[model samples]
Target: MQTMKLTIAGKGEGDDAPLVEDLIGQLGDFLGLLREVEDAVAEPGEENEIVWRVTGATRNSPLSIEITAFPKRHGMNIDQRERKVRAAAAHGLAEIKRAPARPDWFDDRALTKAGGIFGRVSNGLAATTIDFGNDLPPVVITSETARAAAANIVRIQKPVDRPYRELGSVEGYFEGFERDGFGRLVLRLRARLTNETAKCILQGQAAAAFEERSVGEVIERGRRLVVSGTLHHRGPGRLYQVDADRLQLLRNSGLPDVADITDPGFTGGLRSEDFLAGMRDAGSA
Candidate 1:
């Protein structure tokens, strides 16, 4: 468990307190920043669930709220994880304060979510500060600092295009089954190598094979599946979908590797290379 303090200082109307809407907006952005940071720092396959509570509040001139964040799951190293989360939160805030300058650790998504903090200052949020205890200095965002940070966030360059490419075969847990708006079944697979969820769209034989098993059987057991398809992605580690032409359940003793297969009529008598080339040409057409 760890405690942090958030203080919002400004003059509103005739009082030395910030506006209610401004205060609420800042608080929301602050929570969002922490959540993004937590997600960015979490290890693969490990979900960090933090429960935040308002432990105390001060009615002083500059309203200050004490928030305690603790992990929901119990473990031997809970304290260590809490500390790491706190540190990450502090680091994320620091990066935001130095905005227009690239973040040293946070990804684009995290930076985008936290970037709103800088814009709040222009909306009459005089100043916001986050204090993480234990000899660590608080991160303060004033009107001047916020303007600079916000400018930097706006100036950051973004990629022009994020495209999908061919990813022949991928193995992962196939879960999250639902119907799309067009009344088509969509199965989401979290790939083992990438850990990114790929929406699996079954085709031909793949669709027929999936109908053999009940949805309950597939989801409850989290069936591992090998899906050969085209992978849509923006870049490395950013897989979005898979248009699968082949889908098969993986057994304890998995199926033989492609190299071990001796079938010459794998793709209706066409050689593997020629079949793949034809598919690519069809896709481009």
Candidate 2:
């Protein structure tokens, strides 16, 4: 429920401004209530009951009223988690800021300590991938089979199996929903990288096993990696480094339909990397 109220310093007829300040702007005429204060959760089905109170009224010493508006319960159930994924592919973290917590699958990842929010948006990309079927193709798809129509095109990502969240630390997880031929919500269990910091870390590990790629590319690839963490109503989260290249596939073998991931809620910034043809070839243009 989107709830809010106001308390006047001295005895005076309180205008809607101070109250709406943290909420809506100038309502012009009609006073804005619920949605204005905190737009975190979206209004679900109907008007939700929100409790509130205002202090220092002229006729009354204090004013208490119940406001009703759309229920802002942005959450996902095993029956419907797709809404969150669609939001993630584009909005990313911003999408997370607009929902609520529902149920879970696994025993408990981090729910006891924290209350509502999740621990971390699983940064484990390897845990979630688009399996084009069969021996999964390489990260850089170059085969004629690379057509978008590949029958094996499966996006594997699910919600956290648990629901607990600690303060600072993040856990590895996956997308909070499921998909069918077009992706479906069957089971919603659920469920960073480096840079110059890489140079510092790799200073001595030159013998480090690396493929035929520039050090920068390797580091950039590593930087693209992330530590997945779920956001919880209790607090922020804990983080865990997820492998990058591993995200696209779980080995040469494509992820079977049985594969699932643990996605908590939000993800952290692993710093920007110079990836893709666009960034490196800027000089050619």
Candidate 3:
């Protein structure tokens, strides 16, 4: 088991409720995909490097969160428990909402150091979808740098093998992506590969390891580079691919909501009874 500790350096608002709720939710995630919890967001000091800790086991792939925030202002104080969990959710337990249209989504928008670090290192999260027309925009499946949606992020070099292993990666076309009724990222990716492009255009719909995984191969092109790809989706670790011919990015709408996949009781100001009641109301109303 690896004990992850972080010293969150920045201007903290020092709020504990959000922090605590975020933490409990993360711990539940560590326990299992099906585990559910409510309210873990924390409130630490405003503008201080808070020391955070999370005890996790490799077997369960989970951990407990802890933090100590120092007030940036004199006499400023915080609930230590709150500080810890907030740091965890913002940093560790929580997943980055990769708004690709924004360059800083991966860097600047990370709520905390732990979130950014984990987003960079954790496995899965190769690709997230963008729905241009469909109600479901797209959710970021993975954000790990090691395992990117497309193996070669930026297509720079010519192929050295029979079929190009990877083609150029596309991102940053919009200021921000939108989400629709189904909670999916709504966007489309179009690329003109240089001459004979990579044989495969790998796709990662979101961060679940190998979830929605596939490769697209370019067969024809004009003076403009040829483009080809596929839509991949996974369930229960099983693989499925949508045929490129019928697969249209335009069918989807906005982005996926973390709340949908996250534990219903998971915190975000949505209380247990209220959350359930809201869902019920949403269904009927």
Candidate 4:
């Protein structure tokens, strides 16, 4: 387990101290942002369940609230996991300081959520700081940071219609499937090489073909599929959707035990060196 602390300070004290309700609400938003960051940084099936506790509070001139985070999980490489959580926390907070411009490491969903949280948390606080200890610089959140984050959220939420372009054929493992708001079946595919995910919409014949297959079995077995379609994009590196005209299941193939093509008889009785030499001679001629 690893721990990190957050300190929220207000501008005044006594009757002038930040209201309890406001502090509580802001703290909730702060925690929500942290969770968003955690999800953004965590790889599939490797997220740590974090438990938070409010360690103490002070009624001094500048009211302060201290909260600690304890991340729990079971596995070997415990140190590496802890370091991942800590690094994620640091990176998330650092990005908060540069809001209104989304970071490449963070996805659109996380950025939108974090922006909303930052706007709320900075509403009535003097400052907020996250302490990771170990002589690392803390992350500070201020009202200005909140303003920028809010602006970025607004930009992302703005409506814009985009056209889809031909994406041809793409191969990937089937992650799962879902129905969109318009009741269209959407297939979630993770690319074979990059592991990046893409949403493929089944239409017309493609939809009918998918319905004929054992959808549940395919998903359960982690089957690979090839989708030939047109694609839509929100921005660079962000693939919004694919309108698939063709969908086919891909079969797994294993390496052959022997190189049959390398045999002379298989190559028209020509040796490998002779074949290469003939090709070189032809090219030079």
Candidate 5:
């Protein structure tokens, strides 16, 4: 068991939640670059701070590391403090046999001393989905890098080998259809892949590849659809995606057919539970 004590740089002035969150994320990235961590847990601490507990397995036994942050402390210098923590963690992990070798993309100085480090941290954290309904976002490191980088050696530095071309098709019920912020229509399908319901996205040119059917009719849930497209593996992790150009709606066969109506179900009822609850609470008040 190794314990590293590092004072969190920003805490307890005005609104420093964002700063604290960014630092925690950067620390996670640093740790991932150091060793092969198995599990990590984070919990709340006093003084508006957070406690990070990291655990990893070694050839001989399991090793654990705990990093505590004091958010209320003043004079928090991230560039210096981050480098110190990274050095300490690297040295500690080197004692273990199962520790992962440092990657080429890992530039401790570049990651720590770079300008707009906090901004990069913010974008990194936002790329992930967090369950903040129970409490604040858990400061846990599931993967090394937040955004897929071609240069990141610790996690996804090398590009995945690609075949000449891969063709794939899916016949499933239309789960949802929505336009993204950039006016790109995204279609989600619930199809059976490996005996489990796999949710796939049909976006970009594939979303409009079918001129016979409009995107409007495909929004209805339970509409079976057969979408065929070229598959390409991308990102540092090489996630597979389909560039669909052919989409057909099949009857009773669990495939999507063509869109007959130009504007299907354009007028739908808008119900608000908050308005109804307010009306009921008025009588009691």
Candidate 6:
């Protein structure tokens, strides 16, 4: 709680400062006891401190005791701090009863970890919620809590099926290439089908062939070319590239054409110029 004002019965005629200081000293003793209780009950890394505001004391006949509390950084669970304050308050009240001369009138406000002391004024005591600062609300996630959430998430397995088939000469525009850690080149291309365009990846020897024919021209200019190879697989989605081997580029000079070549199956080591001509003829027929 940022500020707690207690109505300590002061010897009205005497110096009010000394009386407030004495009451503050007594409160500090109570805090020491509260600390012990907190240490036993609170989780590790939790901390708290007490402060007496000397200037906050009333100069008038009836004195006011103002004290403040500050807790160390913690997780988002604000309720924990509120619980600690309640426990501390209960403990402090118990100690006050043991005092030989307890304050005739006092404030019993429910202090919060976020520096808030809230209560309605009753019997000459002005208690209310104290707003310390504009700090945003906390994100409550302990290590254990995070681990539990992770454990509850569902995982999907990757699909696997492999039986090589002829994918014939596929026509597409070259996008780019990336060499993996294993020294194997990966070619990314936009394969234009009869009805739709598919993003394709040519790996290993097929990718090497394209690199050799183009002299890595595709990597620099990103040209559109025709590639012929054996289709290893179509992958999970039909949109996946037809994994091919023994690949050959049909048209290395970035050209867009409506080469009507139906799934001509796997064309291992086929020449691009001849394949393009045959496909063009087939389209005419």
Instruction: Please provide, for model 4 over 184-209, each residue's C-alpha lDDT reduced to its tens digit, 9 standing for 90 to 100.
Output: 98998875533458899999877877
Question: Model 4: what TM-score?
Answer: 0.55
Q: What lDDT score belongs to each candidate, Candidate 1 first?
A: 0.70, 0.22, 0.28, 0.63, 0.39, 0.40
Candidate 6 C-alpha error for residue 154, in Å = 59
Per-residue lDDT value at 114 in model 5? 22
Q: For candidate 3, lDDT tens digit of each residue in 74-108? A: 56444443334333333222233322111112221
Which whole-number lDDT from 0 to 100 does residue 227 have in model 1? 80
Off by over 4 Å in 2: 1-9, 12-38, 42-58, 71-258, 261-285
Q: Using alpha carbons, what is the TM-score of model 1?
A: 0.53
Give the root-mean-square deviation of each candidate in angstroms. Answer: 11.2, 24.1, 21.6, 7.8, 19.3, 25.4
> What is the C-alpha lDDT profile of model 6 across 164-225, one tens digit per residue?
35556665556666666776666665543321234345666766676677565555443545
Error in Å for residue 95 of model 4: 3.0
TM-score of 2: 0.19
Candidate that scores best on TM-score: 4
TM per prediction: 0.53, 0.19, 0.19, 0.55, 0.26, 0.26
Cα lDDT tens digits for candidate 2, 161-182? 3434432222122222223354
Count: clashes, candidate 5: 10
Clashes of each: 1, 53, 66, 0, 10, 3
When 2 and 3 are scored with lDDT, the better candidate is 3
- What lDDT score is found at residue 263 in candidate 4? 49
**Model 3 misses residue 27 by how many Å?**
14
Best model per lDDT: 1
